[model samples]
Target chain A: MRFRTRRGIEVVAVADLSLDVADREFISIVGPSGCGKSTLLRVVAGLVRPTTGDVRLDGRRVEGPGADRGMVFQSYTLFPWLTVQGNVEFGLRIKGMAATERTRLAQDYIEMIGLRDFANHYPKELSGGMMQRVAIARALANDPEVLLMDEPFGALDAQTRIIMQELLVNLWQRTPKTIVFVTHDIDEALFLSDRVYIMTARPGQIKQVLNVALPRPRSLEVTTSPVFVDLKRTVLSSIREESLKAISLTGTE
Target chain B: MAESNTLRPIYRLGDDLRPHEPIPRSHYLIIAAASTLSLLALWAGLSYTGIVQPTYFLPTPGQVLATASRMLLDGTLAVNAWASIFVIVTGWAVATVMAVPLGILMGSFKFFEALFEPVVNFVRYLPVSAMIPLLILYIGLGVEEKVAVIFIGTFFQLILLVADVAAHVPKDLLDSAYTLGASRRRVVTRVLIPATLPGVMDNLRITIGWAWTYLIVAELVAADKGLGIMILESQRGLRTDRIFVGLVTIGLLGFCSDYIFKMVHRVALPWSPRIR
Candidate 1:
């Protein structure tokens, strides 16, 4: 996919990128900054149409953003004018669900995210971690078949990120949906994903795909396991070399 | 932990600091009361000391208060106050009706923005006061003329401001809404409108002040009733006390309307940030 910026300069973002995510699979894409990881996610979410090639969901060509897919951005994208309940109800309300049903559904997701007490609280009243949880609940309440998260916990503190990661894993288990998570954090990608697709820097294409054979119901302690460490070591060294090449080519380091 | 918190480099100077956390409502009330009393005291002192020389130029606070009461008793105050309120509210409401949709269009679509932006910018720069003669020629000396004055004064500036506010509705939120199955119209009515509401309310609050600022110009052209007319009549009669009464009444009315707008903002948009 290529994009022309406001300055009218054409830049190739993604090239020769194709991957089929199995039903109910959890996939993560990790790459250096400006590696078009987000661009790839946007294509799936149908927020950005690729310059060439088509994105198909359920054997149908993806035309635009639809309810079949939900997205959680890196930044806190909860509508500031909406309370927790209001935000969670947004998609359901748009879908013309009855108010009582919408409220019940929204409340279910809010409780899932552990923010039942703050159902009436506005986004401004929430901490960053809490707000991201609202964003997640909002996306999930739609009952979308696929959830596209663009570094959802990247804005969080380290401690909060870990807690959020665990909470996400738990939520994923309970709600079995295809999730395509994009992040730059190798550890986060390793911890949460069944398959981690690492991309080359700029004009991004999948360089490697690491299958994490880590056991289910994994905890933070699994991060210290030798198998996890070995995988991390291999991924890191490969990515480090790609990252160095990226910096040297761009001369932006 | 306490020592570390205290010793940490404090970056509390900027407006982003949530320094005044959860102060009681009554604390604000006390501060407001004290501030008003000090200003009143200052006004009284200025007049009593004869520093504001000649009673004709500046009436004493007591004189103004007495005149205000007398006007109230004679029913002139009520009549004129209602007249002023009617025109301001009518003009402001009309401006809001016209500006909001136009602003949204201008903000959302580049084509519309390019078409209207230059014209609006140019017209806004032309003084509303300067356009009074032309407005009178077109709309005449009735309340319509005055309403036109206030409308012209606020509408242009408001459209521009509302457009800016609408444009600032975060892109991510819009994208998120679209991904959530909202149609284009749904995006506008559900996402865009509600998201920009608090900011638009803020814009309305400020432009309402501008509406009041244009009231004197509106009434000065030709009007038998209203605070501006009251002030003009007083000035002609050399009744500085009554003029002071008119001025104070306008100030008091402006303050009350501001309070009303704020109350509306709070009640209508409870999800917005609390003032405290």
Candidate 2:
């Protein structure tokens, strides 16, 4: 994918980046800053059309954004006017679901996210953790086959990010949707995804694909395990080298 | 605030001047009342003491009050006030009905923006008051003529402001809607409208004040009735007290309308932080 800077100079954001994910699998893309990991995710979500290549989801060429692919951004994108319940029910309402049915469905997700008590509260009234949880519920309520998340927990404090990572895993286990998670955090990618796709510095490409050998029903305690540490070491070292390369390349430019 | 005392009291001088420090409701009310009373006192002192001189030019507060009561009891004040109110509201409402959808289109679609923005940009800056002679030639001295003057003053300005409010709808909100399987039209209806309505209400609120200004201008030349006409006639007769009555009546009407608009905004959009 290419973008024109405000000065009207054209630049490649992501180049020749190809990816595939199995249904019900959780995959993550981790890369250095400005490596187009976020751009790649947007291309897949069909928010931006790639300049050279195309994105395919289940044998269908992705042309524009659709309900089959759900997106959660790093920013808090909740409609400020909407209550937690209203936001969760947004897609369903667009699909023309009846009031009773959509409300019931929204209530189920609201309960699952543990925001049942604050379902009527506006996004402004919620904490960072609570709002992201509502965001996750809002995307999941539509029941999209695939969820595309771009650094979803990047804005949170360290403690909150860890908690959200764990909460997401639990949510995924119950619902079982294909999730393509993007983050700069090596540990987050390794802990949450079945496979981690590491990318090179901009113009971004898949540098290495690592399969996570961690067991199911994993807990935060498992992060201290020897196998988890070994995987974390490899992901960390690879990301560190790319980050250095990214900085030096920009310095030369 | 004075650390030398080693004891900080609950309230101190300039306490509320610090950024976002809370002030008690009663304290706020007292400050508000004090400022208003002081202004009135200043006005009364100037006129009653004849310091501003020529009692007709700067009439005493009591004289103005007497004139106001006389006009009120005779019912001409009600008739004139009603005429001005009706023309402004009717013209403003007509502008809103036509401009809102057009403004939405202009903001959302580049084609519409390109088509409409240049003309609107050119026309809005052309002074409305300068067009009065031309308007009088075309429409004569009828209520429709008065309404047309207000419409011309307001419609172009209202369209542009509403367009700005619509244009500022967040991209994340639109993207999220599209990803949720919303069609383009549905995004406009569901995402754009709800997100922009609070700002649009604000635009309507602000433009109504401008419309009130235009009503006075239109009434001054083009009408046989209204607060503006009363003010004009009183000036010729040199009844400064009656002119003051006209001024106060229009001020009261404008304040009431603005207050009502604010109250409606608060009630309709309880989620907004501007009021609640």
Candidate 3:
């Protein structure tokens, strides 16, 4: 696939790559800020208009925002007026699902996110981590085939970020959805991704795709393992080299 | 271990209590009573010394109370008060209905905002009282005229308020809603409207008070019945006591209505910051 900006700047100019994501593979795209990771995710979600590329889901051209792709944003953007249960059920309500079904499904997802006790509490009442959990649950409640998370844990504190990362890994393991996570954090990418695509600085292109052959059911302990360390080193060096090149280019300009 | 256990006394009976906590209710009551007593004593002292004549200018508090009791017994005071409140509430309702939708539309769409904002600004700058003669000319000196006066006073105020609230709906929230598959209608209803509700309620409070002021101005014309009319009639007849009674009624009614609206706001928007 290839794409260019409306201003005629080529963004992802040459990309003949195929990722054979199993029904629910976890893939992470890691690069510096403004490297089009978010743009690629939006293109995959069919939210952005790619100038020269087409996204195919089961070989069908992706049309528009649909149930197949659910997005969890960086900020916990739960509706402030709605209670935890209400926010989770928003998608279902829009689908014109019956009241009983909506309630049942919302309750089930609320429990899944460990927010059953806060079902009646408004979004403002929850902490940042709790609110993000609600956002994640809201996206997943629709049972989408692909879950696109755009720096979902980017705003949380370090301790909270690690906890949320563990929770997301567990959720992905249980549900088995094709997950495309975008982040600028190398360690997070290596920790969470089955495959990591290293991207160049904007206008971005794929620099390298590193397969993280680390064992499944990965834990924080794996972060210290030799394999994880080697992968992290590889990703870090790739990003550093791209950033230095970008800096030199800016210096010349 | 002992030092840590006794690090600091968490409770101190004499010094830890906040100034407002220990005797808030009693302190307020005492201050109010003292102020009232001093005012009454001053009035009595002036009257006794003949420094000011009560018959022409200031009426004694007793005289004002007696006049209020008489009107109450005759059912006239109650009727006039109810009439004034009814007119103000109706005008407020009409003004709110007209302003909110227009405000939301103007706030949401940039083109509509540009087209109508200048007209709104022009109308808002015009003194509401200046419209009295025109309203009277068009509607006659009837309930319609008074309601129109009240509506004109409140409508523009509410329009600016609601528009501001609608315009300030957070961009991040709207974007999230779109990504969640919410349509344009859903974004307006779910994301924008609810986010702007606190601002709308705040404007409603201000407009409600303005409505009362307009009611008084409206009655200054030819109305035979309302608190303002009663005040005007008493002034013409040199009945200071009756005038005092009407003025007090207006103050008390306005205060009570504002209090009621505050309670309603608290109930409706539970997520909003609590009033201190």
Q: Best-fitting candidate, measured by TM-score?
A: 2
Candidate 3 interface RMSD to the true structure: 2.0
Which is the winner by TM-score between candidate 1 and candidate 3? 1
Q: Considering just chain B, what TM-score does every model have?
A: 0.86, 0.92, 0.83
State each candidate's clash count. 0, 0, 0
Among all windows of 10 consecutive residues in model 2 chain B, the one with the lowest summed lDDT is B1-10
Off by over 4 Å in 2: A98-100, B1-11, B19-22, B273-275
Candidate 2, residues B213-269, lDDT tens digits: the string is 886688867577898888888889999888899888888888988899899998998
* Ten contiguous residues with the weakest lDDT in model 1 chain B: B9-18
Q: List model 1 lDDT by residue over B110-202, tens digit each.
A: 899999999999999998889988887887889999999889998999999999999998888889999899988888888888888888899
Clashing pairs in 3: none
Model 1 residue B49 distance off true place after TM-score fit, in angstroms: 3.2
Docking class of 3: acceptable
lDDT of 3 by residue, B1-276 (tens): 677877667644454356765545656587689998998899777655667855458777777888899999999999999889888989999999999989988888898799889999999989877988888789898888888878888888889889988898876677666666777789889888888887888888888987887766878788878998888889888998898899899889989988988898888888764443
Q: Better model by TM-score, 2 or 3? A: 2
TM-score of each: 0.90, 0.93, 0.79
